[model samples]
Target: MAVNGRSRVPTRRDLAEEELMLDTYRGRRYCKQHPSQQMIPLGVADVCPLEHSAAGEQPVDQ
Candidate 1:
């Protein structure tokens, strides 16, 4: 997903794993890292802005 004409942040390794796991179960799986956010569909890997910040990576332009 683009924000303010900027490209989306690349998915981190851990997030990619979680996303894949969630995709396997679809609606049955819950995002353990972000329980409050809406379920991320198969290809929409745009959640968790803080995931990058917490890892010491530079924050993407939102």
Candidate 2:
């Protein structure tokens, strides 16, 4: 399983687990972290982006 443009982030310890991701009709992220033997839509290791800015943090670099 390979993510086209999304790359893995570096970490101190190995995260020997896989997480699945799903999107609704409006393209919303849904986490389905299961270890079943089926096709899954994995997302970036980092947490999802916020809908709006609160404290004017730097925008994420896509």
Candidate 3:
């Protein structure tokens, strides 16, 4: 079981983080433009940066 009874299904970001051996917060993806910032995954959902800002909180129950 995952937090709030949600499944821990791995997103693209999660896989990318695992591939990079990064321990970033859940739902956060790597940012190529701003290496320091981890934004939400978008586009093909392939874990690439779409924006260069901090990844806002995921939608409720997302």
Candidate 4:
């Protein structure tokens, strides 16, 4: 299934794949512009210049 063009909540198999990917980047940070890039050292934050607008939708479980 799809949610807003992205995949829905991951299943157990999907989570296992993600875990393997995470292990490969055990000591690196992800680049916001390109999530596949993990060249930054761990604990360093990416500086995003764009400002994100707040979502107008209210919480569903409220």
Using lDDT as the measure, the top candidate is 1
Query: By how many angstroms RMSD does model 3 differ from the true structure?
Result: 12.2
* Stretches of model 1 off by over 4 angstroms after superposition: 1-11, 27-62
Model 4 C-alpha RMSD to native:
13.4
- State the lDDT of candidate 2 residue by residue for 34-55, as single tens digits: 2222332345443433332454
lDDT score, residue 46, model 3? 40
Query: Sorted on TM-score, highest at the top, how do the candidates line up?
Result: 4, 3, 1, 2
lDDT of each: 0.55, 0.36, 0.54, 0.53
**Candidate 1, pairs of clashing residues:** none
| lDDT at position 5, candidate 4 | 94
**1 versus 3: better lDDT goes to:** 1
Error of 3 at 11 (Å): 0.6
**lDDT per residue (tens digit) for residues 1-62 in model 3:** 26788888888987876856644444446555555556655554645344434554332221
State which candidate, 2 or 3, has the greater TM-score. 3
TM-score of each: 0.25, 0.14, 0.26, 0.32
Please, what are the lDDT tens digits per residue for candidate 4 over residues 1-62?
A: 47789978888998888778867866345544444545433355543333323552332221
Estimate the lDDT of model 1.
0.55
Model 4 TM: 0.32
lDDT score for candidate 3 against the true structure: 0.54
**Over the stretch 25-58, how does candidate 1's per-residue lDDT look in tens digits?**
6544344555554543456564443253455445
